[model samples]
Target: MMLEANNNYDKVHFAVLAIGATAKAMHTAPSDIYLRLKKYNLVKELLFDCYDTLHAESIEGVVWNITEALKSRES
Candidate 1:
């Protein structure tokens, strides 16, 4: 489900969707993904801040990009 971002809530909504989709793809809980995103600040920098670009892609693409970003940032 694609959300049209007209306000802060929409951005938040999209972020949640992205997190949930990522979690599903990775076979983890949404809370885990949320924590990881928060830890890396991707929740803001990538998911929220880049909503314009991310939302234009497919959910699968978004999940792939997010997972790749997470992997790249891993210690």
Candidate 2:
């Protein structure tokens, strides 16, 4: 589902969604929580290129991660 949210709202929403999706996919997610081992964008990109490799990961992180990655790329 696409949401038309402002900056503050999107951050809050992304945090919530990330945590929830991560929990559902087990403790090995890249969205919420502190990520020291793997970055969110890396895991997200891997999921995109090889979804089979990340069978246990959440598909929802793709959109959120892609958006963040795009923002960073533009910077």
Candidate 3:
């Protein structure tokens, strides 16, 4: 469903609805969705760390490792 908002409060309401719909579509609880979001954020952070660690080293290896780590997260 589409929601129209005239103000911040209305926007917040619509955001909540959108989140709920997303959770339902994924067939997971809202808490589970939150956890996945957290995991993705952590992965992003780890990618940055990997980049820094390999900045003076091997770029190809770092990219491979980062891609593997992200794929592992999917499973």
Per-model TM against the reference: 0.88, 0.32, 0.37
- Predicted candidate 3, C-alpha RMSD: 13.3
Clashing pairs in 2: none
Off by over 4 Å in 2: 1-5, 27-75
* Candidate 1 accuracy as TM-score: 0.88
Looking at candidate 1, what is the lDDT of residue 7?
Answer: 64
Task: Give one digit per residue, the lDDT tens place, for model 1 in 1-75.
Answer: 234435678788888899999999999999999999889998999988898899899999999989999998885
How many clashes (backbone atoms < 3 Å, residues ≥3 apart in a chain or on different chains) does model 2 have? 0
Q: What is every candidate's alpha-carbon RMSD to the true fold?
A: 4.2, 10.4, 13.3
- Deviation (Å) of 55 in candidate 2: 20
Index of the highest-lDDT prediction: 1
Given candidate 2, what's the lDDT at residue 7? 40
- TM-score-best of 1 and 3: 1
Output the worst ten-in-a-row residue range by lDDT, candidate 3: 42-51
After the best TM-score superposition of candidate 2, give how far the Cα of residue 29 lies from its true spot, in angstroms.
13
Candidate 2 vs. true structure, TM-score = 0.32
Q: For residue 53, what is the lDDT in candidate 1?
A: 93
Taken over the whole model, the C-alpha lDDT of each candidate is: 0.89, 0.45, 0.47
Q: Give the alpha carbon lDDT tens digit for every residue of 1-75 in model 2.
A: 245345445444544454456545455554443252135443334333444333344556544554455446546
